[model samples]
Target: MGIYGFDLLIAGLCLLFKQITQLSYVFSFILLFLSGSVIPFENLPEIVRKIGLMLPLTQGVLLGKKIVFEDLSMSAATGSSDFLWLVISSLVYLTLGVLGYKKCEKIAKEKGILSHY
Candidate 1:
């Protein structure tokens, strides 16, 4: 799940780069590590932990680990409200990423930064 989310973020950032500067491979790597690390959220300072929990990648990694390691049945995995929230978060990330890319593209066009392709 971490890998999947990392790939998605990379794809999104790449798509967004034409419109935004300071977004590069290093930033993507940092975000990916933040999402995949297993340090307990509660062990972190409160504000940082809250920010971590709000990240979609974190949610994906947690829920993905549960689904992969547990003996939960399909219904138990998908029917639970918590899992539903994870699904929603994943969708939200995907949708927002795409929309952000589009918005950035528009801004780049206005700023005459778009590359001919």
Candidate 2:
């Protein structure tokens, strides 16, 4: 779900932004770097950690870590509030991404920028 939302959001951005390629490429790398994949989230500043957890992918990654190291089952995690927040956040991103894509698609088509892109 995190992957789906993140991909949709980026795809929507590619259609909406003028600097499509660079925005998608550079932003993805930055997202990955801040996702706590390379750095333990515990090592980050409190504010940074909080912000990262708000993003879908970062929360999913942390959930996966909990499952692996804490011996938590997928079913058990579903019962936890943290896991619920992760799902809700992913759904929020999904909704925004889909809406942004539809709106941008209409604008791009009218402006004749769809094919130019």
Candidate 3:
């Protein structure tokens, strides 16, 4: 799941940037907020909470919280609907990341600038 998110992050950066410097700060903040790491998910505004729920990392964060605070067994936690959602989101990110990377490669090849950015 983490690998899927990391792949998506890398592919997104490749698609969006000609140079990657200074982009980490923005990505970090967005990831932190959307993943519910910076604040409790219940504390977020309604709309923001809804948005965060749709993101890939939110379920993982929630599962971790449950495991720690509620002492949920790994098997029990993974059997929940949240785990299903996490799997679905992982597949979505994996697909998007592969497509984005392919697109970026095509563009770079066409531009004849295949050297490292």
Candidate 4:
């Protein structure tokens, strides 16, 4: 759900800022690295790890680890602050994505570029 929100946000941004499509690869690369897909979270530098902890993907990854490797039940694994963060972040991102897309859609319609975009 959080990842879907993030993708929706990016899609809306691309409609408003076409140039972003070109830079999205770089953005994805950075996101993957920060989310600990490329390296273990603990091995990351202190500052990077701190920043990563705030990202939605990081929360998902950590939660998944706890449920899988740690054999924790879903309720037990998600009972902590991490789950709260994930829910909050997901809602925030999803709301922002919908609002932004609506705004951009209006602008695109006004400019007569909605179809092309």
Task: List, residue by residue over 4-113, the lDDT tens digit for candidate 4.
Answer: 76677777677767668667787788888998989998899999998888778888888888888888898876788878988988777677778777787777678777
Task: Give me the displacement of residue 83 in model 2, in angstroms.
Answer: 1.4
My TM-score estimates for the predictions, one after another, are 0.63, 0.85, 0.85, 0.83
In terms of TM-score, the best-performing candidate is 2
Q: Per-model C-alpha lDDT, please?
A: 0.61, 0.79, 0.76, 0.80
- Candidate 4 minimal-lDDT segment of 10 residues: 108-117
Model 2 lowest lDDT segment of ten? 1-10
Candidate 1, residue 74: how far the Cα is off, in Å: 3.5
lDDT of 1 by residue, 51-81 (tens): 6666677666666677877866767877887
Ten contiguous residues with the weakest lDDT in model 1: 1-10
Q: What's the ranking of the predictions by TM-score, best on top?
A: 2, 3, 4, 1
Candidate 2, superposed: residue stretches over 4 Å from native: 16-19
Candidate 1 Cα deviation (angstroms), residue 38: 5.1
lDDT of 2 at 14: 68
Put the candidates in lDDT order, highest first: 4, 2, 3, 1
Which residue pairs of candidate 3 clash?
Answer: none
Clashes of each: 0, 0, 0, 0
Query: What C-alpha lDDT does candidate 2 achieve relative to the native structure?
Result: 0.79
Highest lDDT: give the candidate number.
4
lDDT of 3 by residue, 76-96 (tens): 988998888888987787777
Candidate 3, RMSD to the unseen true structure: 2.2
Cα error, candidate 1, residue 24 (Å): 3.4
